[model samples]
Target: MDINMNEMIKDCLFFGMVISIFAYGFGKKLKDKWKLPIFNPLLIAILTVIAVLLALGIEYESYYASAKYLSYFLTPATVCLAIPLYQKLSLLKKNIKAILLGIFSGAMTSMGSVFLLSYLFQLSHEQYVTLLPKSITTAIAMGVSEEMGGIVTITVAVILVTGILGNMTAEITCKVFKITDPVAKGVAIGCASHSIGTTKAMEMGEVEGAMGSLAIVVAGLCTVVFISIFAQFM
Candidate 1:
């Protein structure tokens, strides 16, 4: 039975990878055809994968055992964002002050709002900390959550939802707020949504993509410091 079980797991290792790639590819096709924000490929891929797992009666752990390999690319992918920033190096230098200030304000607002809502709802320290890093990337958010004795899984979930919301509403929000500047738009999206929103920012324009990439790194650092100070108060 042990041998059989191991063999089964090994054989199914590629199953998760295949399913993920297929689902995302299908989602991309749908988005291309529909051209709608609601049809976000990542969102669709997530839902599709979940549904597939449920329908197939596959345990999430098993699926993740193989699917986690994709995550290995995350660090390199994030680093690659620097390319856009480098391309727009002159623009970054020209508006360094405004960019830094915007990211700082955004990071503060994210943590502050969570603090206020957690207090209003009477959430525990663990829960508050879990949510405090919701606006940052998964890598940094997970570390912060773990350091603060928060639930890492919950932090990841919150971050995903935050990113998806930002990805979906970025354009709408900008229009509603009359934010016409590409740099400001990039900063807002990256500060609020991290990489997922950065994807959308890239689609908007090169300048927006470059600024969004910079905001991700700066806002992440700011959140780390701000969260430490905020935790002392809690």
Candidate 2:
């Protein structure tokens, strides 16, 4: 019976895609109805998918086999972010120095905080490296984790949590910190949260979206270089 079920799931090539879309759509509906940050569509969708998979005894590998196709669009989607950035090119160029400095500072702060916590907690070297790239996008973070001999799976999980937290708290944090500058808001969100957080940044405004998109690229590059140097210490 189990073998038959597994085979049935495996043979249904669209199963994962269908489930993912339906889950996200349901999540969106809930968010629209609630208009609450806690009703975050992505978070709800993730939880819903996990629940369904567990309830059905579906292996993640089978689900990923079909769902992986969706990831093919990730790069293009990221590139599409440049559209807003292009619109705000004048603003970006004018504040290029400040923007670069902000992103660099944010990246350093993220890594430094992780290092300090890891030291305080006495986490293993592998664990420390796994978390070092937690604030960047999945693609870059995974590569950095692997290069630094960290657990890529853990790094991905950390990245997701980091992004979600950033997404959920960005506006509140800005208000509390009195960060009124749109560019600063964007840079902070993108640098700390990567692509997932950028979604929230986009909703904030076009200028915020543009700066957040720019931050993703610049911070990712900075992390790549910084991680390489930092690994020498480990």
Candidate 3:
């Protein structure tokens, strides 16, 4: 009977959903209690699920087979960021120049820094391309990676780690540098880390959240264009 149950769980269609929900719920609980960006619910949920899968000796393919459905909504979720941007239209309008400058500079820095490091480290062409769009959202980054002949899985992993680090360190870094401007905070986080970092911006304040949201959109577009052109030369 126990063996049969284990087999049934393995083949269960809803098992992935169950795991995702459980992991997210547990993560949310920890975030509520700890109130630290390092305890970000998404990060916690991902780590928890990975640990569970490894402990259960389950293959990633088996889990992803059932979990891929959740990924279908990523595009829509990315689009939904416009809500906050719309709400902060006046502020956006007022600081259009600053916002654009910050976004453009940050986007370029992300690409340039990666290129320089990849070259300095003597990384292969594939590795360089895969890490190029690490600062963008996964949906756009994966597309860029595919076009650049990079490994999609490696791109995704790099994006996640970049976002987690950005979210975890943005505040402390800001304080150390005495960056108290709301727009600056938002733009810095959004451009450097994309959506994951925007979560921390949102927690900081409405202005920061709005700017961060706007930064994600602008930076994504900029990265797509720049990476495409850069890849042409590669």
Candidate 4:
């Protein structure tokens, strides 16, 4: 197999863009079909990208080469979440205790669950740490995984799956529990699910959307602190 690093990088970017578009198209179809709870665009995009990459027998390194530049945006995109939080400052101040506790608990549970489950399976050390930040936002989770000497790529997959599960279940959980308050609703989804859950909350209405946006930043921050505490204790 002839492998050119430059060519591989270019291919990653090209395929990543193409798959992302396909996922967007699929999401529109899903929305039209009324599969509201399960049809998250990020989930669609991740699945589509994986399928295409596998089918084409392409190496991820090649694609990353071309796509690495785009990865830089992850940081700024995370920072942009501040806009939504700022828009709802009063709302945050009103429920600061619940928001902080709930997010911190959810974040801890997410990581702790992955850790316990993977350990029981006797996975390799690399696999264990790679899955550590599975519940947090992707950019931060991946960075943490790398710093912890884990596989960033695997951690990305964990984040995607965790986000999808959170997005898919938030509505059902809320409904079963008869949760009507937008603040509670948003916090539940955002803390448990992250961005995908936030997207689902957006479809709910302004109140829920605002709350969910707050969830994203709060949960992200809480997750960071939770991980730090865990590291210190360990």
Candidate 5:
């Protein structure tokens, strides 16, 4: 009976589902109770799942084998960003030049800063490659990382850390920098932080949300192009 039970748990179909659901639910509760950006549900869920896996001595491969199903919705999730963009279509058209410029600047700055820091720190080539697309969404970043001979796992981790940090600090950073324009704030957030930062942008206002939504798509494309070009030199 013990052997049978151990085998059942090892192959448990619901293990992944249970872990994700529980982590998110717990994270939501903490966020609601604390009202802190650091308690962002995604970050909290990741931590909780990691802690559980460590305590149980579960290998990451086993968990990911089942949990990879969650990635199926990533593309659709990005498409959902278009909803807010459509709502602000007129404003976007009117200010297309400025918005495009802001997104381009932000995307370049994000990748450039990472590269500069990597050089200064003398990071390994693998580390540099993994971090090049940290600001882009995970789906696109993973592809770019693969093309650049980066470790996809490290890219995903860096993306998550970048998103959480950007989401937590963007408001304060904007205030200190005196960035009063909603469009600028939205573009900065989405270009540097992706979906997680867009959550904060949505809370700021409809206009910001719309701008951030647009920035996510543009930044993703720009990162892909940048990586493709850079890969030639590598």
Candidate 6:
């Protein structure tokens, strides 16, 4: 007899909750105390969790089965980003042109540069399509990736990596380039990375977070629009 899928999912969820707390605590310590370059809380937690489960002879497949229900929240969780955009409506109106230009340019630069390089590498159609949405937010990127027959998991992985890197380098890069405006910083995070970058922006302060939130919406819309055009011509 096979194990019940529902019960399996519960186990995963329970473990995930525990792991997340561990990750947070780990990240917090890194942020507050000794600043070690090797302190990637998520990475450390993920590896530790996986190793513990594996050593205990727990099957990964069973864990995923139980957590499958939790995965249902992914799309909706991403869609909720619109709330922040609505909050910043007034600010957006004040500098609409500059914000729009900055966001669109950043998004185009993100996707275009990836496409070109992937093309140079002779990537397959599916691989190229995957990169197209890498600059957009995770939720929209997953939806777009699915629509274009690209691998959603691959898109998600790429986007996460981009977010981590973006968050890490944003401050340094912005200062070096003299990007003194909050709007520009926000757009840069959303376009160059997406949700992960927002986390970094959040640490910067309220203004930065608001801008990043708004940037996510604009960047997602811009990618959809421009990619559609690209598809029609190519």
Q: Which candidate is the best by TM-score?
A: 5
**Prediction 6 TM-score vs. true:** 0.79
Question: 1-234, model 6: which lDDT tens digit per residue?
Answer: 777543554455566555546765876677567543235565455556567566655666655554455567887887787777788898789889988998888877877787778778988887888878887787888888898888987887787677778888989988999988877787677668777777778778777887888888888988887886554322
Residue 209 alpha-carbon offset, candidate 2, angstroms: 3.0
lDDT of every model, 2 decimals: 0.84, 0.84, 0.84, 0.73, 0.81, 0.74
**TM-scores for candidates 1 onward, in order:** 0.82, 0.84, 0.86, 0.79, 0.87, 0.79
Candidate with the larger lDDT of 2 and 5? 2
List ranges where model 3 is wrong by over 4 Å: 1-10, 176-178, 232-234
lDDT of 5 by residue, 28-143 (tens): 99999998778878779988998988877777767766677776677787667567657667777888898888888878887778878888988877778888899998878987
- Candidate 1 residue spans exceeding 4 A from truth: 1-11, 79-87
lDDT tens digits, residue span 162-227, model 4: 777877777789999998888888877877767777787887777777777777777777766666
Cα error, residue 233 of model 6, in Å, equals 7.7
Model 2, position 70, has a per-residue lDDT of 79
Evaluation by lDDT, superior candidate among 1 and 6: 1
Give residue 213's error in model 6 in angstroms.
Answer: 1.4
Query: Which regions of candidate 5 fall more than 4 Å away from where they truly are?
Result: 1-7, 75-88, 231-234
Better of 3 and 6 by lDDT: 3
lDDT-wise, the better of 4 and 5 is 5
Q: Clashing residue pairs in candidate 5, if any?
A: none
- Supply every candidate's count of residue pairs whose N, Cα or C atoms clash at under 3 angstroms: 0, 0, 0, 5, 0, 3
